[model samples]
Target: MPRPTSRWIAERASVGTSTVRRPDRTTWIVLGRAGADVAVVFLDAEDVELGRRTVGADSWATWAAEIEAGEAVRWVWNDTPRWYAELLAAGTRLARCHDLRLCHAILRDSALVRADADLRVHTDWDATPHADPPAAAPTLFELGAAPDAATGLPEFLDDAVREFARQRTAIDGSTDPGRLRLLTAAESAGALVAVELRAAGLPWDPQAHDRILRGVLGPRPAAGGTPMKLEDAGRRVRAALGDPSANLDSQPKLLRSLHRAGVLVESTSRWELAQYRHPVIEPLLEYKKLSRLLSANGWAWLDEWVHDGRFRPVYVPGGVVTGRWASSGGGALQLPRQLRGAVHADPGWCLVIADVAQLEPRVLAAMSGDRALADAARGKDLYAGIVDTGAVATRAEAKIAMLGAMYGATTGDSGRLVPRLRRTFPRAMALVDDAAREGENGGVVSTWLGRSCPAPSAGWHAAQSLASAVEASGGDETRARRWARDRGRFTRNFVVQGTAAEWALAWMADLRGRLAALDAVPDSDAAPRSGAVFSTRPHLAFFLHDEVVVHAPRERAEAAALAVREAAASAARLLFGDFPIDFPLDLRIAESAQDD
Candidate 1:
């Protein structure tokens, strides 16, 4: 358990009473505790009834909040509950309590905290399930679902491999440039385990070969770890499904067995678990190894496509939690952190790559009644627009500060500048700021489309209730404190970021539908190359957090550009169709991410 800072713990929980002062009846309490701490923040509220009846006052929300809050404070030490007892026994004075807020600026490296923000990556953004269809879903991949490709055999040589595996001294093989293919006997059965260099458009390989595959086949040491207790592991699997005998089958036992052995990442999303393998995991592993070694310097092939104008990247709608799309595969996210040379019309056609500017913030400004912010955002990079409006001194600073503010950042240069932004863009800032404050206090926050981050603990509930009470208490300290820093901040930004995500998803869906309408491929080889040309059928080749790259033919480059822009506008109109704001785009024609 973590030790609460001397200044942060509530008066009742503090270690010493020196310089002690009672907090206002209503006060803002920050929460960053692990597990059940969230529940504690909630249940320990100053005003439980008012907190219980928040908008959408269904019993369901109240019950859910209570259950979640109770769960938050739960701690398991050697399978036994523990935590807070020690502090309670110590009878610590209120003076020992420190600020409840876990600001990275101060608490990050402090010994009292359990972990720092730097090490605390965006882990909460759940590694969701894979949206891509299974190998069986695609029509062309039918042969793969049959016995032929089960062992990673190429379609043309399927018969030969079946015969080879059936009558061989060894059915196993390793894929390396030298001694890449080998047939060997295994302990249990004969199988073919080798890599094959697939085409460019295939989704399995390309990028994330390490991160994704590592989670699959795992690290290949000179020697594998001690084998797990098959029976012992199976027990956990059976218990998890709530049926004692469900895991009797080899498959169920094996899945549970692998999970216990750490071969599979246990998650609720089955789609994300698509990569899990036990006996059936070899094909994916083979693909990963082949991809890594084949294009060892992976970007060489990526660059090859850029140079030849044959790269069309797929986009996954709602790929990221904040409403952004990710490339279906390849190093789309890992694009070398520099711009690629401008694509000059493939010797005849000029590349027309355009991206919208200041997208999320402007969407937010329009949503909130902040005329000042909207006016500044008009027809410009919203960050620069803020700078021009004196939110900050420079665009670079504006970029860093505004991003930090929207996501509840309160450290570094942002900590200094966000206050100024809040004053200028109150209406816009209020939406997100309120969410963060709620988050800090263990209260839940949601997107415009109703996606919500679950509420934290009893302690969190108490904090929000306390803050709300401060508001009701007639300009008292709790209300003043909450609004001063948190409520205003969270509310200002949430509407913008959440709405922006919605717009992005619509754009991706539109592009995907458009691409699906193109002419059919006559051959597999032609299909991969043809995806690069958008004249007959423009396909999106690469999608970044906020930008997209299309590899179109010499004739249809301009049309593809227009298609991308129009889709973005359509997305805006569809989402806010009834609203009267013009969600504009700052389209730029570029060749690559490196391009302007």
Candidate 2:
């Protein structure tokens, strides 16, 4: 790659004829492919083009590092994994980014944005990130091409600039620009974190994982064979059912076997099975548990996912409609607690594990501005605080009532306890109740940061319309009411859950920066398995909704723990801004993420 000569820079500067801002004044750096070269467009705070440069693929990382080192600028790109993955492989870690694809999605459907906003128009900018197989270090040039049908997002330089402008316009013209801007930034930051998490994978101890599996399932069996303990449980269940030929793995077969034995359960679900006073129940449950372990994170899973001491699960940021992340593979989101001990730190490092307590309820308190609920949640367990408020007799009841309120549960113990909560915390209860009503009426509800719940589907409208027909049948009305209530429950939780997701993003984003700021350990003590960009520093290892695990050198473990706690506080402040609500974490600094 040839270096950009002074004459080449001057010519490019003159071609644009835009007043070049000082390096310090550059606020955004947009990157995109330009033919065989990469176009780097610098923008000012107002999104005005400050200057531009076209660098070859061979020199892209070097140029990016130079420009990044010169000033604090947020890199604007189409997709994070496509661009940032290559940079990280080249040992170039960026502080921040503006992912156009992600921001476009948030702004386009956001209830806060005007209906007629240009961003609302269907465009390729609304495309999701490509679902490509995980590569160790994908090259920028190899990933760059014209917008393909696989991922509708545009790939060239001009496309990114136009999309960025549109996003800015949408946010600027939104009803609450401040909140929308924050949401977009937080969402984009989450995109970067997602890639980093995959690149700097969670450390794993394969031997420990094998041990846990053996202890639970009793030895790895031959290919296509069941484990010893699982087979034993199946035998015991079969014996109890008096059917030696019964296939415990088949739910239909198992149900028939149970009915033949007079267990008489409609389904083989654990809850239903537990209702019977039968000898098969215990062994059946045991079989199911072992089967889940084998299927989910068993020997096969360990062999496939854990590589070179790291478990690199592909994280799909903003995958859920409510802005919660979803894993495409490797079951990162569903890591079993029993196997958490396998999440081992490096020989010279420690894991700073932290997860927020009662995140959704606390978010409800803050978003609703429910001072009474906030007071109850101030510096103590939110449920215990509710107990103190006399909302319920015990902490367990307090939790049940709060969950019932948010989830729109209207039966059983939840139904009994919910009314007490409605009276005690009217503001919080009213907020969710209002959302439920809107959802039932086919309306949309937005999170505190403006991520809107998806509108009712066409099928929903058809059902609702059928129920309201002049000659509607009783079943039609019943089904419609049930569907409406189901939607109501979904939307009731959407606001709190979505907002909680935003808070988690803010927490992780803040924590990402803080961890980056910590001093790097000596090379001899570095955790090279965390990848080249993160080996020497305290980098985020794993993130699951409200929890985060940071792999840090022993020397920086305390600092990383402090960063985790401080980030939670920062996230709460960023979202609620002095709402007097707290997000306390259950934090532990240890060598392995083993449950106590």
Candidate 3:
């Protein structure tokens, strides 16, 4: 009789005797770096060793591509970006992967994991990603040692096997194995999507970008000069203050100028400026706007980032504490609306743009299992539905109330409206309120999928302790209360935002697979600019927190739109099974991503 599977079995490497390819069997191939060579270890569905092969560094791409050509296999590796980016550069595509580094981070901090799990003690797996994109595809023989700090864990076959075993053991011992399993799977899939999005860049139009800049700033300035419109605005602002040569770019000088002109604003922020009636306000605002465009996403930006009609930004998945993606370079997250016209599609193709209407509140409704809130969210406008329930007088009030409830607002209109929401939607209000109280009391709160908020800092604890003393000063108590409220706000928002991020990951992962399964276009119709794997098929081009842009052939635009919707439904179902909450998307199929 076969021995029952256990951690002991998982640690052992049993090389299969079969030399011939087993196309019918599902295999897990673990890739590792051996000194001046590449180590490939294969395991079958039950993880019994299938075989081991060492391919020369020079032939690694060819070997990997051959394996990808097979029926059913999932690659397992230390980091997706490190291994997959090179294979993608070589025109190889993969179906699935188990990213050990990402999964380790998830399991280590996950609230579901048992406290005694060994994964919690593996401090080596806590390394951050390399700030730069992966090193250029190296010659297999030259890829000797893993770069220090590039990965936290060892990049050898044995270490990979042992780490994978530890991760499995943690998952099996977790309080909620099913939820952790799904979260890990979704997190791994997000790793794949991040790499692919970088490989298959968003289509860009340089001319359109140039036009927007020119229209706003009056053409690019010659070397060592500001744009014509920006210079004109600066002159008007200086003239209004009766100092023709006053420097508007310098904040102190500008503030002094405003004060001298009888504008009693404390700062140069737009909102503060709006409160004033000074002649300099409008021109100063315009100058700041144009100056930002010049500095952030101007001609120099176009020259550096955009290449071959595509804007390829490096996406760092799980970078933010709330699990939202962060960009290393290319300013992808802050893409200005003015530049949307630059995000055009290739000829004979379309951009399928979609974003959830109000992801966080909808997520809160589902996660808290507040049937009333869920019913309010059954349609397109969740805020309007809240108004129908008499939570507030108007959609705007409902929005303010909901935002206040999730973000821990204590003042202004949001604060005033929040009480009404609490009275109407007690269950939904209770979740965030509890999270906030826990944070203020030095406790950690977790998202629906078990990603926990970070622990309170020593400084925070010290402040709270000082305030508890018999002789504590008013200032001490005030400072402590302020810090506690700040932490409360952070934890309160963390659960909603983090869970929303998980939903987005599931959506993108499902959409990526659906797009890959679509029919490929003929070579003549391929957009080679998208790189190898996506050149001939519909694929994800860009993803922000709750939005996705799919570049699809015109013939498949309708199908791609349907795929996107279906993927969203699948993600919602996977996250909140039978919760009866709906995630309605504001979807559009257009030649360019320009808003109407």
Candidate 4:
């Protein structure tokens, strides 16, 4: 059996074989850096069932000290249960490492495991129901009991997905992706993920669902704990929606619970607080602190998330590249590993954080078969190295300009800078420019893998054609000339952005698959199981931009770090097999959310 991602993670981190991969892994391990205090074990996706345990009740610090004293340990990788996750269509199978033993049982009844089952399903997210003309009041019809989803959705796929991702990347590169639509998607998905988690018998953030309902359902009145009639609340909803002056009486329990959990804050009678924080909101104070760091030092604010004991980040599917994902809501991509001070050891615990560096760009170079570009990046930063090869002035400037060029960043410093970069690096610039031009023309793009960017609409085509005609007339003064500029900009960047997104999706999928074989456990606490010490699954709890957070224990923490790195390495291998590009990662360990 090709081992799963977690087992792969453990084996690579320590100089040992894992049972999941090599039968050699089943043999007793020779002592290594992680020491005896930690060991490899197994658990369900939620980490609720018992499998195996390694350490005694001693604090993690005590075990670390013992490892320093020379002993080898093999415990299961255990962390918190993501029992609450459910709303996702693809489900957790895409992001987490699973035991074939466990997955076989879990998926026994699931459609995914059924040999005859089809994988595609369609929603009206991209349907042109509104194509006829914008209606003042769009028809509100019941969409109960979804029909079998549309097949060959690639036919229906539009440029929205890739365009959005590129816009996001450019925006992410320039500024924080503060409280955008994706945040809503992530939070909503998280709420559903929470539901599934609860079904798995883990701690469900009831407070989260309650917040969702309260937002949809107006506030409640001050009454006893008796259940309020839905009719009572319905009346309140009518009153709130109709009356201009009447204050919305939110469900005190849900609203107050969110307030207590730090998930929400009340800004005024009309609105509840969001994680993004706005002026006049409670989350604003925290938001401002992060914004200041991002604006001034860029990524310096990541230390703030290191507090609260463990890094619990959320993972979004299709969050980035064409089939990619984004992680701003949970700070998945933006971690401050060098500042392990943010993570703590509890009184006797320790923190371990590590990552694979040069991931996406390296994947790009390898995928594109640009040996010259890959060779230039063989032993140094790709951008910095690119600057050295044929760029002028600072390496940072070259990198910025190149990235900006690839993503259709125009009219700014990156815009001004990209032309110079193009002049110096013709081949590299030509590739990105070609991709960008495809998007502008409403054409589809693809990743090294077969993932395709969506196409444009008929209206979009008409708009572009009109713009082209005006430009062709050589009359910059015409109104049509002015209109075409907008179309030109959109088309210019679409393909490149879309293709980049496609690459991201494949990278995540490949990484998830490879890491599953590793059995990367954490060194955290364990809840009991039947005669066995089933450790908690190292659940992802938060995500931002490109970083992921795993709430792990000391025993499994190092393994988790190994998983993060190997998964990335595997992603590179999966995309380009073997190339001249090198992707390196940085590492850090911490004990709390406030690591700084």
Q: Name the best candidate (by lDDT).
A: 2
lDDT of 1 at 291: 37
**What TM-score against the true fold does each predicted structure earn?**
0.42, 0.93, 0.91, 0.46
Q: Per-residue lDDT for 1-596 in model 3, tens only?
A: 33223222223223333433443455677778766556766666655565665667788887677666644567888778877888888888887898888888888887788878998887767766643445545432224555334322224575677777788889989888888878888888898888888889999999999998899888788877888998898888888889987888889988988888899889999999998887888998988888888888988899899999999998888899988899988989988998999999999889999999999999999988899999998975999999999879999899889998999988999989999988888888999999899988999888888888788889999999999999899999999999999999999999999999999999998999899899999988888999988998999999999999999999989999999999999999999999899999999999999999
Q: Which pairs clash (backbone N, Cα, C closer than 3 Å) in model 2?
A: none
Segments in model 1 whose C-alpha atoms lie over 4 Å from true places = 1-319, 323-329, 339-351, 457-496, 512-528, 531-535, 578-596
Comparing 3 with 4 on TM-score, the higher-scoring candidate is 3
Q: Candidate 1's residue-wise lDDT over 182-263, tens digit each?
A: 1011100000000000112212222433333233334422332311233334444555444466533344554574466455
Question: Which structure among the candidates has the greatest TM-score?
Answer: 2
Cα lDDT for residue 275, model 1? 61
lDDT of 1 at 256: 72
The candidate with the higher lDDT, 2 or 4, is 2
Error (Å) of candidate 3 at residue 556 is: 0.7
The true-versus-predicted C-alpha distance at residue 561 of model 3, in Å, is: 0.5
Q: What global local distance difference test value does model 1 have?
A: 0.40
For candidate 2, lDDT tens digit of each residue in 1-596? 55433223334433353554443343677777665466666676666675666677898888777756655678898778778887888888888899888888888888999899886774766665654434534333334666534333235565677788988888888899999989988999998898899899999999999999999999889999989999899899889989999988788887888888999888888788888898989998998999999999999999999999999998999999999999987989999999999999999899999999899999999999999999998888999999998889999899888999999989989999999988999999999999999999999999998999889999999999999999999999999999999999999999999999999999999999999999998899888888889999998999999899999999999999999999999999999887799999999999999988
lDDT of 1 at 167: 19
Compute the lDDT of residue 477 as modeled in candidate 2.
100
Model 3: what TM-score? 0.91
